[model samples]
Target: MVRRVGESVEARLDAERERIALWLPVALGAGIAAWFALPTRTHWIGLLLVLGAGALAGLLIGWQRRFGRAVVVGCAVMALGLLLVWGRALWVSAPVLALPVVTEFSASVESVEPLPAKDQVRLIVRPLKRPDLPPRLRITAAGEQGKGIAPGEAIGLRARLMPPPTASLPGGYDFAQRAWFDRIGAVGTVLGDIGRAPGAGDGVQTLRARLSDHIHGQIDGSAGGIAAALVAGDRGAISEADEEAMRRSGLAHLLSISGLHVTAVVTFAMLIAMSLLALSRRLALAGYVLPLAAAVAALAGGGYTLLAGAEVPTLRSFIAALLVLIAFLLGREALTLRLVAAGALIVLIWRPESLAGPSFQLSFAAITAIVALHESRAMQRFMARREEPWVFRLGRGVAGLVITGLAVEVALAPIALFHFHKAGLYGALANVVAIPLTTFVIMPAEALALLFDSVGLGAPFWWVAEQALNGLIWLAHSVAEAPGAVATLPVFPPWGFGLAIFGGIWLLLWRTRWRWAGAVPLVLGMAVLLAQPRPDVLITGDGKHIAAAQPDGSYALLRERAGDYVRDAVAEAAGIDAPLAALTDLDHVACNRDFCRWTQDGRTILAARGRDRIEGADMAAACAAADVVISERWLPRECAGRWLTIDRDTLPQTGGLALYLGERPRAVTALGAGDEHMWRRPPQVSGNDEAVPTTSLAR
Candidate 1:
């Protein structure tokens, strides 16, 4: 009997494998295309070569009926699809490709409409209108403009008008690549203006502006206005205190209408729609309840949850909602593993870049783990055969919530560390409280406030909602500040990130009794992090003072700046607060003071002319016998020593002379320099230094 049961389980696994194989091509193709389409400087020939090789490999494998032949064919198809998609994106299809090299520009908002979290202000600009340039042109303005600008008003901007860079953080994050899936390629910020903003203030934007004004007018006295903003996604009117409250409470996600908020709205709408349909029982309409509920869910949840914002998590949730709605409309099964996989595939296909984002990984990991736990036979039996009191039932619910938080925290911990460089040690506990409050209390209250507004009794409702959100904020801030709230993680190598991803997928999808197999990546990721190499040169620089520490030894600085922001950054990066003090006493100097110094065995040498600045001299002779020549000024023209400039003005085009002298003239010890020309030439000792016998400076 045990053998038979094992065989049945194996058969189910095979069936799932077969199902995944069938739909694999679409997912693979979309992913490949998106990868190739990313902004890169490589030529098309390389891509074409890859395409040909993949096609040949697929053909050969299929002809031989090799292992994983079906998978190979699917991969080949996906590669081709990606090549086509990205090729089109890089060439003719992209608007950025078609745009002229714009020089002068100006933007004026024709309208500004309020969205859930931000104001969508539309602006039109005359881009490079010179007859010598492209005459007919327009630029749309958007994003991080600081404050909301109104219609009929214009801001002057100067920029090299081109398509926005594809979203991908170089070493951090990418917003443009995600927007590519959403079909937005162009954006701009004001630089300078040729004239005033152009346009007449009128239409729907005006109405939205009026509504925003009216809401603020009504709720300005209390926290109600910001509450309305949170509900409506008009963050422009929110007070600093209210914003702080939500941020502190870890409930900031609520302020922005996201998956949690949408799920609640849809569930509530679904319940209402189902109840109304149930009341009409005798009409043979039992089958229609789900469909009606789904439609209402779409109406209430779709725009706000999905369409209202650019956040990738909302889009993922909306995709799941779509899957659920379609299933209901067809009277099929609900919320299964297959449905989750399907939703994931859809999101990956549409926004391939999102695969690397925290939202996509965290949201889906939490949901999938929760669903798996919820569907376990053990869990079902416990819930069904519970002969316990209400207290026990409540305890079980709390236990379930705790389990959910742990699952999500486990899944997201590596990613959070990888991205933020700091892991939230208490995030799980914070989430346990914050998630329930945001989902159950905050979202519903905000929605109710909207309803109250329609009934002309929103003021009281809005005030109550504000208090709830404020309480949540206070909770997050408190949690954030709790002892050991976050722990710093050593930087991990790139391969570790790949390993972590591999392990996460294994845990989530491996159809094996030995689920512990997924722990492999986790262990490897941690190992890689522990083994990372330190940088050669480290700088803790803000806009003011600059500090540098060599890998071999001590630290050096030009001077202490106005603020500690820079000094603190350096100290943190170097993992030493003690070394920064050596830099604090450095005398205050001019903005461009190119000081260079090195501290060794408690000895210090100033490379530059001490208070007396020199224009031309064999300064190298003075520091020839010293441990190191520290400079706070330019290299004397006649010094003729191997020196590397540490100063900013290294360009020859900017009226400064470029020099190169080195038998390996150590590096021209400037703050910075013009070019490699200075580093390449043999050291030439001119004037008095020519007769002085010199030794090669140690690297």
Candidate 2:
């Protein structure tokens, strides 16, 4: 029996040997993710020890066969990943604004972005005279204050600045985290006239801005905006409604200047370069075809990546494209799985923090799944079109494109739910139309229009591009509005999401019959997610906005005056449409001048809207009787509720709170309990669980 088991184990190991390298990146990403999820950073000494031990073990085990060597290598890669992000976090750690400040200072503009709806321009500026402030400040200027401001200009202004905002609620997006990665410490609004300052800025930004403006000039309205977003990654002109529609239709990926756009640019550049060079008889005979074409493709992709601000998605896409071209130049068929893993490793090494973001997760997941699918024996055989009629070949191509789109959507669904609380189910159908239209018609026409515009004949092509964009927009909106187009879930446990990801990767990457075992965890994870109990009460981080569930299968907004952004976030988290009904007219709850009482299933919640209300209430009795008590003001020690109490003291500690009312009550926080991410706090705040004193948001 022992010998039989040993042989079985060896068989499994041998089967997976070929995939050992592909799993290295997965291990590395796991380490990086583990680091980010921790509430506190590991001690430097411990981190160093792990890194050293893993590396040494990896080297010593190289002579060992199969399983043992693979284990050591994976551990070594994971350690490397952990070390890379740990070092990065320490290196980039800097002070963030602790409080709001209003001051005057001169700054060198780092970048300029315009918002068309508000006629406002935004700038990332380095404050010359205010080193005490955050080094990078995002400032909004409107009207004459921002008129004609270019990227490299030095400007002066007085503005009121505040720390980058944290997540509005538990499980919502972390804006501050993103700002931290971008090195933006403060966000503000220009309060007065903008004046010329002492220095100039880089010209690369200026060039990008010019290109965006040129495209916007050619197309009109949101269609023009889509054109610009595709070509130069300028999404400023795209309206919120159109953007939302894009998200709902699953076509939002097209708008992001990621894999599709970069690949198209590289392919076009190579083919055009080769064809143009082939026209020259001498050059054709010289047989420099592939080399020169590959070079041009590289230049084009790299230039476009830089011009698109070289953001994570664009850079990642460009890296993958460059790898493929290099493989072509080396006369080897690039293995898709290896290419993806290599690209991921490079990007993670450079920007380890991106592993936590949706862009990185979604982009890589879609690619890995698609590659695995096509690499399958069944798909390879099904897609083979040799000796087939032209009509049959065309049909197969169309069917394959549609099938690929559906596969991508399936792969991306869980991730989208984890990040955005929603996923578009119809993106595959929409993409069958949208992707081909964008790839074959719109982009090509736009390029031709730009080329012809140089010689004063761009109008006809521009018109063709405009019409195609209009159709694309119409398709997105139409598909988005279709019944059951999107799948949504309320906030799910992150652990479940992690399990889902692991299971998915396992099923996709492994060739063994045991790959079917992945389905167990995949289903279990999604079940855990869908079965999570809904929060009865939702509170914003600032303690100014609140949401409560009503008995009639609906939610009520306590603070009726919250902005659209806040409302939308809360709504998404609750798995409902935004602009929730105000609590004022709700019939399910009883309200008095001092407090509101919501009761269901023999449990009660007492919430105060203002300090006056809290002062007037009988909190000791209320706290004892009620399942949960909530207020913005500090609650007395004696006023603890039966289950939970969230006030200024605890609210600030947690950032935001979600109360689940039931037989055994529980609470979830926006940053999770004891979260101490450096970007999430100010310089002097303690990272401990003890509450920090803070004032309630002023009425």
Candidate 3:
């Protein structure tokens, strides 16, 4: 019996070893491919680490019955590996920290978005980071500096061009985190008024603007015109309603020149080229013409896509399109899967952090799912029934739509919940209708608009395009505003994110029988996310109204001249909104009283300090015998005395103050709290009032 058991265990181990051997090479190849394609600041180390990790994972998982243990260990190892990758990401994406010396630089204004306030406009300035002059510096025109610049003007920029800022809000959308992966730093804006009219040439800027104008004129403010803008990656013309509708319907990706948009455009253009070439007499010429046409289309899309902020998915799609065309030109057999792997390997090597981002994860997952779906028996059955009947075709089309929708939806669902805390309930339906409209009607119209603009016949085309855009907008709005359009979800943990990713991977890889395993993580991720708690306090006000508590549990606000806005903001931030009225009920104007008095019914009284002249003397008297005296204004005049002045700026105009009353109630100690540790007293106060009494009885 013991010998039989030993043999069984050994057999299982051998089988596991065989499985590992089969998969290890593929994993290494993928990793090695990625290492080569990605750009690394510390090149050799990153390459070595990736290969070594791949090898380690392969060796560790070589035993068959140890699948569960191997998976657990592999996950732990990957988590550690990711930490190292993140560190490298930080170094490579170093933001420009120092200020730039602006000697001289010139750039033509591309476009501007006017902010709600008339005085400001968000200018997307393309400053020549490197100039002929020695004093010229690379500066980004983001945040405060990026505002108020206009198009067609060459304004000088003199400022620091540092790397992007770190994510300010923890667990929120980190623009800095994404920007670093993309190698974008802050660009400085013009220091003065527009100096010269930007010299015009027939570049992308000219073409894009002309095309946009022509479309606007053709559609005459129609929903279709806006749709054209969206399809062409020109979002400047889309109204707030259109934006809101797209967001709610989860079809905003259609307008964003992402993977779906780029792939659709490229695929359609390729099909047209292939069709035209197939009818040609010369086989050689036909082959060349088809590839050339596809190349031109890719370039066209690339130009527009870049102008519309080319994100990871758009870049990926463009690269994939070019690769496919190249493969055809080379007379290569259908090798799309290999090409996709190559692309992923290449992109991952360059930006390893990208693997962790929403764009890369969702796009790749969707593509993988599509590939797997096509390989399934369902797809084969549909292909066989193509010649059977119209009903078959109809059923197949619907199935295809459903399959594609489900794949993409599953891929992006995790990201959507994480970033927006909401899921588009009708997303599948919206994608089915809106995507076709944008791809076929809208994109083609945009291309025509560009031609019309070049020939100075832009207005007519713009008018016609606008009408179509309006119609699309109307449809989108109707769909988006429908009841149960979106549902909210709670935030998830890092582990939950991991589960979601694994779910996607499992669904994409497993043939059919074990594919159901993907749902385990998907469901778990959703469950984890929905269980998070909402923030109770929300603060929105200027600095002086209310000071935040320091590590030592003390808060400070301006004592002398406080406003209702500040008070309201503080109350909201502190999650004291419910008790706000009660705090005021005891004739207390502000909660920053020296002494706090509370009754059984939840009423609170703030006793006024001797030096501070509060709103109501009678109310102050009522709360005189208080549990604790928290100084609202400033540090006490005397540290060891009972006389407390709540006015800040009394000592020095530092910031705010916090006082922790010890066992000796009369012993006053000042806790300086604010941006700086300077004592500030209220300006309008007498010296005597501000002075501390040597000794005082319990009044």
Candidate 4:
């Protein structure tokens, strides 16, 4: 009897596999994603040639009816996909400024958006001169200098330009990589007033800016900003406090133009089209209803994507929705894994670098999990029941929301912990109220407002949207304020994230009890996270600030206010849960105006900033007493000795440093020992002296 049951299960699994051909594209996308994640740069042309030759050989073998023809063909396709991704990455690589330089030139403004700060605006400019530079440069202008700049208008200004900052540590966020993909090679601050030249903004950008301004004029405060963000993807107007609240409450996704917004807009259009078709008996009876509704939904999604600036996330979502609509038009089930796989394939082909972004990861992860759940036997059984009463349907809808919220939260938890080292502990509870309110109230109202605004009759709709937005914001704030709402997690290594992703895919893509095997890798990933080591000391990217980890799991800041951003980043990466302000305790640190000293594991460290202080007698005494000295100023002749030291010249190339203290202390920088990326400066030659050389510091 046991053998018969096992045979029955095997037969069921075989049947299930025959029904789904989606895993092919998914595997292909995985190959492409893997290619993009490599730290080492590839010789794109050479690699593609090699891969192409292998694929051709595989295809020829498969054509001859080889023993494993299907496997050979699949492998060939995946290899080709990886080559395609590599080619795309190479095509998008732009030239960045090799060194910091100040230049004055006039350029056409592509867009003007306010920064989170009070008196700063970011200008996306197209440099008229220096054609060798990247097509676009993102410049941060102080005060009201950039406030008057209009899209497409030519403006002249002098600014210091530098390559985007590298990651603070290896495997941390790489702003330079993101900037490279964005076609922004340089970033800097405006040094003087902008002078207007002869030109107008680009037509599309002008329209978007006008629409954003009109929306803001109609609504008020954070509500207007939220409305603008939903309708036009203009998040510049949103208050930082509200943004923080949404993030803390796990409702930040709602504020962005993501899959949820795209789905909502499409559903709204479909319902409207269906209702109108019902009024026309001939159309409803002619069997054109489903196709017509799908067409309308596709149009709505496309329109929304364009309105939202066709960002990567919105574009991906629209592509997925379009695939589903096409399936519906063809009289097939629309919510299949094949639809998502195809969408992912399209996104990877268009912008392979997007695979590195959080939005891409989170959105696709949620969609994949949801589709898998829909295909599960449990959900199938639940949906198979006969039509129920209104109350039962309402209860089911609420339950469905809860289940979805929980599933997405769980699916994305590992990624969140790996990247940000924080999880919204109360995200499920918060979403129970937040998702419904945003989906049914806020988003719909904003859509209506946008529709009305285009026709100059949007006042009432904007007011309604504003009211709903207020409630949503309040809910986010309240939830964020709850006790233990946020959970700080230990840092998870890249391999841990890899294992978790693999386990999730294995469990979701397969049918049958064998899928339970995925639990092994999932548990192993959790173990890796728990076992990861924390850095004992961290230095800022600018080398102006440093922090030491205390025995009690707190950080001692070397400077009070200079490296606030780095302080927070290091604290999060080190799994320090205390508030930033409370991390530095004077009881454990000794400091004077010029220098601060801290000890960890019996090793003394000294940090100094000002030039005058570095030349003072106090600095000499501190350097003599400490085992490691980090000075913002150039290293003086007197301080050369066995004690390790980092000074101005080496800091720029290193970016940031992480120290591990033991019997033999060691150091690692943001640029790894062997990293050879474009943004990294060339290695510096060191002279033989008592001053510890860069290469010797890590030894």
Model 1 off-target regions past 4 Å? 1-70, 77-85, 88-104, 108-170, 173-252, 281-286, 305-307, 310-312, 372-385, 530-582, 585-593, 599-699
- Indicate the residue-level lDDT of 66 in model 4: 35
TM accuracy, model 1: 0.68
Q: Higher-lDDT candidate among 1 and 4?
A: 4
Q: Report the Cα lDDT for candidate 3.
A: 0.49
The superposed Cα distance between candidate 2 and the true structure at residue 603, in angstroms, equals 2.1
Please count the clashing residue pairs in each candidate, in the order shown.
47, 1, 51, 4
Candidate 3 weakest ten by summed lDDT = 677-686
Name the runs in model 3 displaced over 4 angstroms: 1-154, 157-169, 179-206, 213-232, 275-280, 284-311, 326-339, 382-384, 387-392, 452-464, 538-699
For model 1, residues 411-520, the per-residue Cα lDDT tens digits are 66666556544555566677788777766776677667667878788777566666766666567668766776655543344568667756665566544554467688
- The per-model lDDT (C-alpha) reads 0.50, 0.81, 0.49, 0.73
RMSD of each candidate relative to the true structure:
12.0, 4.9, 13.0, 7.4
lDDT per residue as tens, model 3, 564-672: 5444334323322121322223332444444333321122223333455445444344434444333434433232112333333442222222222334322111212
The most accurate candidate by TM-score is: 2
Rank by lDDT, highest first: 2, 4, 1, 3
> How far out, in Å, is residue 686 in model 3?
40
At residue 259, candidate 1 shows an lDDT of 60
Model 4: which residue pairs collide? Answer: 151-201, 152-200, 152-201, 641-690
